[model samples]
Target: MRKLVMVSMLIGLGVLPACTRTTNTMGYIVDEVLVAEVKPGIDNRASVEKALGKPSIAGQWDDKTWYYVSRNTKQTAFLMPKPTEQSIIAVSFDAKGNVASVNRRGLEQVANVDPVNDKTPTLGRETGVLEDLFGNIGRFGSAGSAGGPPQ
Candidate 1:
């Protein structure tokens, strides 16, 4: 019986390592060699696109900037994924279609934003709950009954 328990324990120990999964990756996989070929001020949009392909995200309002984003996450078993590595390459262009700058950002630049729940103040007369509930009671009338139109 002791030998049986020892064998079962050994089997369980062997399976424990398999339970943890390998790192998972998502988004664009940046190649340093390809990125290096893009020279600031000299490389234009066409050349950059040819070298690095289309960007993951472009500037929200315009095409003046492009971003290549990549992230690597790891999770063991049922735990939430934690980002182990992240890369964001930002490329900006001038209005004339020439490369203006090339910059890189990491995970440290991520921001956590929490939205406020306060109602927006508007220019109107404020009314209490009872006034609001009964305010429109006598205001609504059928246009047909008022001789405006026929249905």
Candidate 2:
């Protein structure tokens, strides 16, 4: 009975860490109730800011667009986190600063961006290890020989 209990305890301890799920949330936290209060063509930037606080990102070139991005990811143990939910609230303003459009998107709109794997092509020729070590040896002549004698 003692051995059985010890084995069970050990198994439980091993499984506990594996079963743990860690959830990570980034960017804005949206509330449907607050979002409903915003009305396009009426709510200006100030009102929008007041209602939604601040956006996660603004347009790079101009301030006409605002983005409120949110993502929820979960990971078990040492596994890479996977996005379980994603939300993006895009609000655009016209020249007058009034909200022109309010759009919302979900995980379906998320794009998988695969970064380029190839290294950048440099202009210079690649030198080998030995060339790098001994390349500069004879360039400057002997170390002691200076312009005339040392002062």
Candidate 3:
């Protein structure tokens, strides 16, 4: 009985780790006070960078906008991570390099996208396995033909 109880306790201890959830923070770590201090017109690229650090991503089309993204996710063993909190701060700069606008967004902007089927549908003639193997057999050429052995 004592041996059985010891084995059970060992098994329980091993399984405890798998039952616990893991939390992960991805992208820039946001500091609310610093973010709040960044003011439009007063703060410029250099000040913003000093306060908030470098941005997570810059504007794709132009260098006028900077984005700071943060996300917190919780995941279980062998399971996909689920976002619990998300924040995005977009700072737009004017031609003079001063901050033009500062915008903050939350989890409401997050979108769930589902991909299509695994096999991508392509534009072409569909052939069977046998057709693929023997398709080129006869097409090679016959005697005296361009592709055939010379007579």
Per-model TM-score, in order, reads: 0.66, 0.68, 0.71
Instruction: Give me the runs in candidate 2 sitting further than 4 Å from their true place.
Output: 1-15, 114-151
Badly placed stretches (over 4 Å) of model 3 are 1-9, 119-151
Clash statistics: count for each candidate? 0, 0, 0
lDDT of 3 by residue, 1-151 (tens): 9999999999999999997899999999989999999999899999999999889999999989999999999999889888999999999999999999999998998888776886677899998999988888877789998999889
lDDT scores of the candidates, listed in order: 0.88, 0.90, 0.94
Q: Estimate the TM-score for candidate 2.
A: 0.68
How many angstroms is residue 63 displaced in model 1 relative to the true structure, after the best TM-score fit?
1.4
What TM-score does candidate 3 get on C-alpha atoms? 0.71
Q: Evaluated with lDDT, which candidate comes out highest? A: 3
Candidate 1, 1-151: lDDT as tens digits? 9999999999999989977876988888999999887888899999999989999999999999999999998888778678889999999999899899999999997666555676665798998999978887667567767744467
Sorted by TM-score (best first), the order is: 3, 2, 1
Task: Determine which window of 10 residues in candidate 2 has minimal summed lDDT.
Answer: 142-151
* lDDT of candidate model 1 versus the reference: 0.88
lDDT of 2 by residue, 39-148 (tens): 98789999999999899999999999999999999999898788999999999999999999999999998778665766665798999999999997656645457643
Which is the winner by lDDT between candidate 2 and candidate 3? 3
The lDDT-based order of candidates, best leading, equals 3, 2, 1
